[model samples]
Target: MGFNEDRKRYLAGLEDKTYFMLGDEACAYGAIFAGCDFFAGYPITPASEVAERLAEELPKAGGLCIQMEDELASMAAIVGASWTGGRSMTATSGPGFSLMQENIGYAIMTETPCVLVDVQRSGPSTGQATKPAQGDMMQARWGTHGDHNIIALSPNSAQECFDMMQECFNLADTYRTPVILLMDGEIGHIRESVTMPALSSIKPAARKMAKPGEDVFGGEELVPGITHYGMGQNVHVTGSTHKANGMRDVTTPHVHEALVKRIYNKIDDNREKIIRVEKDISQNGQSKIGVIAYGATARPSLGAVRAARDDGKNIDFMRLITIWPFARKQVAEFAKNLDMILVPEMNLGQISREIERFVNCKVVSVPKIGGVPHTVEEIYDAITEVAS
Candidate 1:
């Protein structure tokens, strides 16, 4: 179908209403509201609800929702769909996400604009399909091969899952790169009341289209626009090194070097514009410690920080909304004059490593694995330990 028709059909399926729903289901509705007309995903725990809902709802909206044989095909299908000039997405948990890495790399290298939702579960390999863990935190940033930059957002609540899915699509389209919504299974399965804003309030990013006679990958614009396959653009897309016209140039040293740098720089240069975080600092401006957390773990950390404040401690809390393309500048500024910073995560010090890179203060990691979130007391104790 044509772009307008697909978009109109998708828009017709949206309703600006409030409802209590699981994060996964909220994500599905968010996709539809965001004008996503194509969904290709394999069923996996905690993330299966997303595909299930889309399977029923997408077709009704005149879109296609295909259950691929496996995660590999699912990831590939979404990339192919994006070339057809439609928004596409897929959802998966740990094992399935791992299976999608190679194709995820292809999507990144080719600059395909699409969304990927990884509802994290306990894992090394199928460690616990139904349990929650933030083990995939680092994988979302580096699971795909080679040196590349990708946008990833973390949603700590069902409302955020509903809200950030649209942001994910916007970021993906705006940059012509795959965006990941790194959600944990706990949040995915938790049900919460969500009030969706008016449809008009959501501003989605439009895809940049190459002008007639312009090379698909050629432009002074860092993120070059793309033309649909049959539009006579004659674009050649490959995972290997390519020139502005998209022709494969695997042997040319300069061609590969230039293309790779452009891809990486597109994100690096825009890092400030992309990174987001929620901060509550010392009101009296005497905070000596800060707590940094993301994903589901941020929930408890927020509570712990509040309790610490009640006890007359100078504690600042920063919740990460953008996980990848780490908010180095923001955190570094927050870290200034602070005695220490504590990071509480569901895994063993994944993002803590990144936090340490940007901050000069004492960085402490409070990791809790085995499919459970850190309690308020646990986080508070860690804060106390570091503060002392």
Candidate 2:
């Protein structure tokens, strides 16, 4: 079926209502609310709830939900579904996320729009299947080889999980690329109150279609519209470097370079619109210590900032809502005036490395692993250590 028909069939089931929900459950509903009609995922801890919820709910809403053989197939399936002009998604944690890497890269090369949720767990290889960790932060940005840009968002609460998933779909549709919703086991299992916005308030983006005479992949727009597989537009979808007409041109260096550059530029050039960060700088504007965090780690980091302020420490916080594309420009701008930046995460200094790259100032990494999140006291201690 065509995109509109698929959307029309499934979109009617999403209703405006509030509920106390888990982060994983909230994400599933958000995807449904954002018009996801195809879900292909393999169950894995902390993230399995997402797949479970979709399995029961999607069918009730006239959508398709498949339990793939593995993460690789899950990722591949969503990309295939998306080409048929329907919103598609998949969810998995660390090991499964690793398995999905190659297909994720293919999604990037093909410029297919889909959403992948990585509800992170501690792992190099299944270190803690049921535990929360932010070790996947660096992997999320670089897991799929080659120089490519991707949009990733981190949600610290259940409400943000619901909210960001909608943003993920809109971003994917808007840019014609995969968007990652980076969550962790802690938030995924945690129950919290979430206020559902009215249906009128949630405006999901429609898939952009190529004009009758336009090439499926032709246009100067960083993100050009695409014609679906059976849409009667000459569609040539391949992972190799391709011409704007969507035909493979592997032998030409210019064709390869141009194709790759356009993919990166579509995201990098529009970074400002895609990036979202919550800032809590002191009113005096004299804070010397800055804390940068994302995902579940941001929860305690925010508390630490508040605790430090109560103790009269000059500390500020920047919680990343958008994790990928690195938030480079904003980090650089924030780092320039700070004495030190503390990166508190569940992993051993993954994102801290990125912060260090952009700042000449002392960059302190408060790394914690093995399933336990950093306590507010731990983050506050790091802030004091940096200030001293």
Candidate 3:
């Protein structure tokens, strides 16, 4: 489901086809297809290909792509670019994702819509250069050091690298909040076939705008995503607590509450619309066992589900495309219906913890660390043991 004539114009040379590409390259093309006019990122392995591809393609697309000296500046630049009416993104690995933290906070503070791609490699500090780790799952939600809510999407394959980026921008535009596309080195480096987006299905949302002059922003430009952009619009944009028109007012408490509450409200208000979960079909909800997974783990989960079904358990699967604002509604449904809930991820039960918090049922977490994704057998046994 994807594009049209307008979409066709944006990707005139692109079409539905199968091609093998690194996740980073697919991400770059994804950003382009999502109408990204600017890209800023620092080089970090597993994610460097995103920056590299953008460097070559952005200028050609009449978009601006920059390699900021560090991750901090890279994030800041994306925010600034968004204010000027450009959809922007930044890509990095764990270390750079850490550096982008405070500014990510600032993006939250300002209600700026942008994308951050974290191609996770093994690391607390530069741990594995080429290996994959879903270690940043929790970090994506809580790393910035605050009580703020954000959206994070993880992709399992190169195809998702292309598709999730589109979803990332769509979430950002609709909610006017920062959206993170989380991937690990395994998914980011693995090449796979991705079908082209449907031309008619891709309708892009422009930043709701106000004119440059003539009172472009009024009550509509307030904290919630009422106003997008208008040329000559003297909208007061700042990280400080802002008024309806977007001016800074740090000394006042009401403005702070209004601003902060709006950030949370925008996403909270749109939670149902934003949450995305993919479930593999397993006949009439009679699934004997279910494996709940996201990111790269879902890849193996697929195999595990098939194996279980073949072994007579009639297992099914639930995969997540959107992680943050974690698809609790769907997970709850699955938790209730399935005989068992098994969440397998590369990290130590970050998402499984979230799943437990929502549904009134038991959750079994099968976690893996040391930078490697679980094998199909690992997930299969974890589910069957519990189901048995």
lDDT of 2 by residue, 1-388 (tens): 2224444455444455668999999999888777788999999998999999999887766689999999999999999999998889999999999999999999999999999999999898988888899888888899999999989999999998888888999999999999999999999999998776665676778878888768666578888888787777767788888899888899999888888998999999999988987898887989878999988889899999999899888787898888887888888888778888999999999889988888888888899999989999998888877777
RMSD of each: 1.8, 2.1, 3.2
List the candidate numbers ranked by lDDT, top first.
1, 2, 3
lDDT of 1 by residue, 196-273 (tens): 767567677888889987877756889998888778767788898889999898999988888888899999999999
Question: For candidate 3, what is the total of clashing residue pairs?
Answer: 18
TM-score of 2: 0.95
The lDDT values for all models are 0.89, 0.88, 0.80
Which 10 consecutive positions of candidate 2 have the poorest summed lDDT? 1-10
Q: Where is model 1 poorest over a 10-residue stretch in terms of lDDT?
A: 1-10
Query: Candidate 1, 307: how far from true, in Å?
Result: 0.6
Question: Which ranges of candidate 3 are over 4 A from the true structure?
Answer: 1-10, 198-201, 211-230, 284-288
lDDT of 3 by residue, 195-252 (tens): 6675456667755544344332234443343334454345666666666667667789
TM-scores of all predicted structures: 0.96, 0.95, 0.90
Model 3 alpha-carbon miss at residue 23, Å: 1.6
lDDT of 1: 0.89
Clash totals for all candidate models: 0, 0, 18
The candidates, ranked best first by TM-score, are 1, 2, 3
Q: How close is candidate 1 to the true structure, as a TM-score?
A: 0.96
